[model samples]
Target: MAQPALGPAEAEGPCSTPLESPVHPVDEKPAPSRLVPAALQHIAAMYAGVVTPPLIIGQAVGLDQAGLTRLIAASLLIAGCATLLQTLGIGGFAGNRLPFVNAASSAGIAPMLAIAETSAPGHQLPVIYGAVLVAGAFCLAIGPFFGRLLRFFPPLVTGVVITLIGVTLMPVPVSWAQGGDKEAADFGAMKYLALAAFTLTVILIVQRFGRGFVRQVALLIGLLAGTLAAVPFGLADFSAIRSAPESLDDQDDGEGEGGQGE
Candidate 1:
């Protein structure tokens, strides 16, 4: 059945009325493409950082280049695995969906060094591992109970904890600025200081002036620039990375019977 056509004014009324159209809210979403690439670049930047500490420590403990290389490889592999677990999350593990790499924290250095002096030959690595294992267990033991204790932490206590964290972290920046090692031949050299300054400048510049992709990749860019600047000064070494083996047995835990680097 056909109806009479509407007048121009009546037809226009429906089109002009704001309520005539069903409105849906639009959300501005960030581009996934940008985030994915930026994330990969971030992973690339942290790869070296995750591997280098074990290599340096192994060498300090008198491990051969091969053994140190193995330690480096293990460190990288473990960190990658931990990161995967943290990001993807198993049944009850993992912290968040964001990437999170784990390593032997520097906070344990003083304790480890103290243990090293008294530990028997080839006992260091095992001792370190054992300590780490125990620490994890201790955390597990205390976590739920400690979480409940959060109610007791008032704002003042929380603020004090935060202040303490800042106080502790101040030394870390100073150490990096002066070069990571105190015994290095060029420790506190201008070259090292310049590298640190350049790194800081890169981060500041990227944060201040960069947009989108550049901003997302700020950390990677800063690290890369800093490393590259250090390369000509012989600060970067691929020697350990290249020689690193896939086998765990190649590294000697601090135990003499356990093997080298111990």
Candidate 2:
């Protein structure tokens, strides 16, 4: 005898199951219009950090203006290349293929400064380079094992490290708020403090009220706003950029004469 007609739900088969949807959607690539501004924001955020190391080291090594310019250019080039590699990655061996800014590390500053102080003036940079090469080799050797060690760093340890980093860097912003140079006539002036406070308030307001991309680029907005605020207080200076080329030209001429004498 034929069975009664089955309903649509049962007609497929007893084994049939509904297809499950993904809990989270994959991220889509952003359009060029959206990407350019985002990229600029990232660059603005990291620009100071990438340049500061070269600036400090160049001065510490007594590099002439031309030499310092070359050092700055090289630092920027290396940082851009490293950032590209980190973001795009090569084969499986290099880079994590994450959104990371690879720049001259501030961690090495103290060691590099120590090397500069203890070594002969002519040998200081070479010694620092040699140390860097050794450290790179050590890191390469330990790369595989390093991932395993990360499991030991639980949330507590991670939090402590992050807190310590913030604590260590706190003095930097304080110095900026005090007009950078402790010996300057305007150091710790009320005007500088007010400008800093205005910048901080702007940042907080943006973070609290701004939406989407505006919120994401809040730091950059804060920086631009702070500079504008400082301009009215006579704190924003453009003399350095105006004189840089002339200084470099003079240094190059001095070096040429010194080379002829040698």
Q: Which lDDT values do the candidates have, in the order given?
A: 0.69, 0.79
Best candidate per TM-score, number?
Answer: 2
Clashes of 1: 9
**Model 2 TM-score, all chains together:** 0.67
- Local accuracy of candidate 1 as per-residue lDDT tens digits, 154-234: 999989876765564455467768886788887898977888889989989997899876775677788889889888889
Against the true structure, whose lDDT is highest?
2
TM-score of each: 0.55, 0.67
User: Clash pairs of candidate 1?
Assistant: 122-254, 122-255, 122-256, 123-254, 123-255, 124-254, 125-254, 252-260, 254-262
In angstroms, the error of model 2 at 162 is: 2.5
Estimate the lDDT of model 2: 0.79
Write one digit per residue (lDDT tens) for candidate 2, span 1-262.
9999998767876545544332332334678997788788778667766787777777677786567778888889999999999888889878887777787777676667778889898787788889989998999899989999998999999898767655655666688788867889989989889999999999899989998767766777888899998887787997756766466578678779999999
